[model samples]
Target chain A: MTSAFWAVYLREILIMKRRILRQSASMAVSPLLYVVAFGCALGAAVKVGDRSYLEFLIPGLAAMASMTQAFAIATEINVARFYFFAFEEFQAAPVSPFSYVLAETLAGVTKALYAVLIVLIIALLFGTRLNYGPAFWGALLLNSFSFAALAVALAMLVKSHADQSLLTAFVITPMAFLGGTFFPVDALPAWASAILRFLPLTHAADAARAGAFGLPPSPLPFIILACCSLVFFSLALSTVKKARN
Target chain B: MIKTESLKKSFGRTRALDSLDLEVPEGELFAFLGPNGAGKTTAIRILTGLSFKDSGKAFVAGVDIDKDPLKAKRLCGLATQNVNLDSELSVRENMDIHGRLFSMSAKERRERTRELLELVELWDRADSLVKSLSGGLKRRLMIARALSHGPRLLFLDEPTVGLDPAIRRRVWSLIKTVNQKGVTVLLTTHYIEEAEFLAGRVAFIHEGRIVREGTPGEIALEVGKWAADTFQDGVLKSSFFADKREATEFLAAAPGGGTLRKVNLEDAFIHLTGKRVL
Candidate 1:
């Protein structure tokens, strides 16, 4: 079981190693554009709390990057399932469903961490220095873990490549914009804030922003993110087993 | 090496396998001869632990698949009908991963990969991406990957489904070589000659049940030694006889001239089911 886990992870690492340059560039493009457009051009006149808006936006951008990059693994899974038929190879092997899901989810977390590193690099270049403490890292890891697990479960349920795109459009896109990434969720109406509180990314963005600001860590968001991770990971295991049958 | 008794599987209202029973002894090259939709792939999938059976029992390499699927799976390797190789990776990487799945050491994996690739005559193209290889090369690589773990039993489902005749013959030779090395092989194919040429024992499956099972010569003898095909009013009619002289006499008495040939697995299949294997 341990060997099979590493075997599956090794394949992903090899593929990522070959495409490192291209993937790094792709990861950098969005955050770089967001810094230029929202942080530089629009932030000169606005203030978030006592600091400039760039400082606040940087942590939110980090939160969003972790979500998107982690969820991106579903595209790879779908391509393997629909076109290359590589998932069938694993199905025919002796690898357990738990090992397969764990390996793929870890691969997704790896990609998410890489994207977060790029965001930090961009933040440094923009003169927005934030605290890099354990709380910040914890929130980011939990966020990535939750979304990556969700990606695997949804990848198994989607019937075709088109359905995957629809999932991204409907599920991930809405969460990205409305999950308190661009602005404060508390600034919205009471009803809207109540709804957004249920989103995992909302807690992630809040915890990440608070950690970056060097504020006292609150355990509520961490607790919520951890619960979400466990639920999604369990769902991933079930879906993969169902796919095998 | 393999056995199944009263195995059954169904999808909705359709029965993919129904009360199927089979046994392949160690070191024997067996063939499941049937047309499409005859439950050949389903049976292989169930036996290999890739699928679930509705009822009945299956054993591989002395392991009960339902009770201990991982152990059974480790004892067998399957080359499916589709070319399911990781096209983005090189041939060596593909084989290496399969070895790792079976928990082979790095040294063992390297040695096995080289040995199997050489056996399949693919040593020279080990670094080439699978997508860049020809259809025949991909099939050969799949076979080599299947054997990289040194499995006691190998299941090949339509290993030569869409290849040219010359390439198909080359694949046949590879399968024969693997079987010669003492691996129990269970093959499924619709190609009549593929079974007749390679399998030591062949089972004819139709609509998810085995109609006949025996050696190629034994099953062919069940129909006849010779076949005479005559066309009357644009329809082809076939008649089988045990003696060459009897077939010649029947051909002579036909209203129109016909072709005479030796009986094959297809003839036996058509004689039993009244349908062509194709």
Candidate 2:
């Protein structure tokens, strides 16, 4: 089972490695823009908590980057489904469903980590040193898994590139901005905050900020993210079986 | 060997397979002939563990497919109709990944990859990306990848679907070579001549069930040795005869001239199912 999981994972890694420059470029754009357009401009004017806005912004950027990169698996999955037909390849093989899910989720996490590195580099250049502790890594990982699993489920439901793009546009993008990636959910109206609380990314941002400030995020966010990951993973699994039919 | 008893599958209200029973004896080169949507692919997918059967039994190499899918899948290899190989990967790399998925050791994978690539004559293009290869080469590589794990039973689902005649013939020879090495092969094809040339036994499927199945000669003999087809106002009426002498004689007596020819498997299929295999 482990070997089978590695087989699927390694295939993605190999493709990513072959096209690393192209792959990296897709991730590079947002960080460059965010750091330049927001970080430098707002650094002196704003204070987010006990620290500078740049420091607070770095973790949020990391959280958002990881979330988007992880969820980018949906686009990759759509390509495999619509073009390469790799999903059918795995379907025909003797691989178990759990292994397939594990492999794809890992691929999403791996891509998210690569984005994390990009954000780290940007932070370094901007003279922002945030926490590099276990809590930070753990929250980042949980955030990746939840979003990646959502990507897998959505990938299965949508049939075409246009539909996938619409999902990215309407669903993922809204979640990215509203989930407190760019600003504080606490600043929003009570009813607006209630809805944002339901999104996994909202908790992810909270957890990420806590970790960046060298504090442990509340167990509540971790629990919610864990439940979300499990639910999304289960949905992806059923969708895989449905797609075969 | 492959066997399915009362196997049923449905997608929504459309029954793709309905109590379908299939039998292929050990070491036989069996061809499943059917028109589009005759349920050939659905059956293949179910038997190969890519899809689940609604009810009933399917076994590949003696293991029940539903009960032991992974174990049964281990005994079978499928070269699908489409060129499903990863286009970005080299020919060898595609085969290597298949080997890895099946848990082949490094040395075994290396050696098997070499042997199968050479067998399919893709060894020369082993280092080339699959997308860069011609259609024929990609099909050949798909076959190589399917065989990398050395499965006992091989399923070729319209393996030569879109290839030109020459490349089709080349694929035919490769399949023959593989079958000769004692692998039980179940092939599906719309090309009637392909079935006649390669199949030891042929089965005709229509509306999710087998209409007729036998040796190519046996099926053809049921419709007699000869047939004559005469067209009137874009409609063709056919007549079968016990021999060419009788067929030609009938053709001569017909109101309009008719084309008399020796009955082939396609004629036999049309005679039995009233539907063209294509």
Using DockQ as the measure, which candidate wins?
A: 1
Query: Per-residue CA lDDT of candidate 1, range A37-74, in tens?
Result: 99899877888789788888888889999999999999
Summarize candidate 1's per-residue lDDT along B24-142 as a digit string, tens digits.
99999999999899999999999987788999999998899988988888888889898989887899999998998899999999999999999999999999988899999999999
Residue runs of model 2 more than 4 Å from their true location after superposition:
A42-44, A159-161, A241-243
Model 2 Cα lDDT, one tens digit per residue, B36-76: 89999999999987787899998888898777888888888
Residue B116 in candidate 2, Cα distance off native in Å:
0.5
TM-score of chain B of each: 0.98, 0.97
Cα miss at A127, model 2 (Å)? 3.8
TM-score for each candidate, following the candidate numbering: 0.97, 0.95
Show pairs that collide, candidate 1: none
Pairs in clash, predicted candidate 2: none
Q: Which ten residues in a row have the lowest lDDT in candidate 1 chain B?
A: B45-54
